[model samples]
Target: MKLKLILSILFVATCFVALGQEKSPEKGLIKISIMYPYSEGKTFNMEYYETKHMPMVASFLGANLVKYTIEKGLSSGIPNQPLPYLAIGTFYVKSLSEYQAAVAPQRDAFRADFKNYTDVTPVILVSEVVK
Candidate 1:
């Protein structure tokens, strides 16, 4: 019937409008992602990173850090393909300035600890999370 068709059109239009709305990023929250790309002859000690390095970093971050996560790369999408990254570490903080202030004084300590873990240079990204 015409009523059924009209309702269907209205439902579709409502869905479109809902989907078009953009999600706003969380206020005063910053995400720092540290990624280590995979390469030939590169070495990564996951145990050292997870057990020692991250904990040290967390201690420095202190109350500013909300939470953190570590991810170990296994393989690429294609079967038998090499992984794109050796590892990834992400942490969330309440304030970017606070996080920076916390790490600035200890930058050298972090660099020195790197030699104890991996030779791969890490890529860092600061991002805002939207949901």
Candidate 2:
């Protein structure tokens, strides 16, 4: 009756308000990474870095740390070759200009922190979608 109709309307209104509140991520290049050859031996150091370092860097660059993915197997020679762990993070921006500007300071921080974990330098490569 009347009560049922009023409840339905309230539910629909509430759903709309909830959906509207979600923030849309800006269109830009998200920092995707493939941090590989993680030391299987230095389990403790690696774990610490993953937990502590990544969030600090992500916050500095005004970016969202999307996920940490463990890469495995080779496409060309999956039978023999094994892929390494690849951790992914993202920087949402209106354009590359903003993205680049944000990371410059944080880059040095990453380098310094990363030296403790592995000898190889971490490199940042950029990619733009073409369609």
Candidate 3:
């Protein structure tokens, strides 16, 4: 009886682990944070980023835009740092590699087109789902 119980426990544990692995959420989401710096006398660049650049990226990437936000910073208490405007784009996916394959072409096209405007480099950070 003890032997049977031990074997059953082990089998249950193994099944749980396998099921957990298959449901891993880290393979499903992405977030990109865009930092728009304080460019003196060129505020149009910000608008350009919003109107021209962003729409192109969104249409091209074809990924679900979970949330896009602008984070405004404070200047007075933040030392000498210029208060940069930020745009965050969240992407959800089924697999990381799939996400990459989907976005690569659009990224290349955006890079090429970005030369016509100011250097607006984006920092990409990704995450997955849970449960």
| Stretches of model 2 off by over 4 angstroms after superposition | 1-29, 37-44, 63-77, 84-94, 129-131
TM-score, structure 2 vs. true:
0.50
After superposing all C-alphas onto the true structure, candidate 3 shows an RMSD in angstroms of 8.9
Q: Stretches of candidate 1 above 4 Å error?
A: 1-28, 78-81
**How many clashing residue pairs are found in candidate 2?**
0
In candidate 2 the C-alpha lDDT for residue 86 amounts to 32
Prediction 3 TM-score vs. true: 0.50
TM value for model 1: 0.76
Name the best candidate (by lDDT).
Answer: 1
lDDT of candidate 3 over 1-131, digit per residue (tens): 99999999999999999887785444345555555445555332446666776667666445455444444434535677765543343444445575577668676787786665555555565654544
Every candidate's lDDT: 0.91, 0.52, 0.58
Q: Which model, 1 or 2, shows the larger TM-score?
A: 1
- TM-score-wise, the better of 1 and 3 is 1
85: Cα error in model 1, Å: 0.5
lDDT of 2 by residue, 1-131 (tens): 99999999999999999988865443333445534443444222456455676656556545333333333323333555533433333333345566567667677777777666555434445664231
What are the TM-scores, per candidate, against the unseen true structure?
0.76, 0.50, 0.50
Please rank every candidate by lDDT, starting with the best: 1, 3, 2
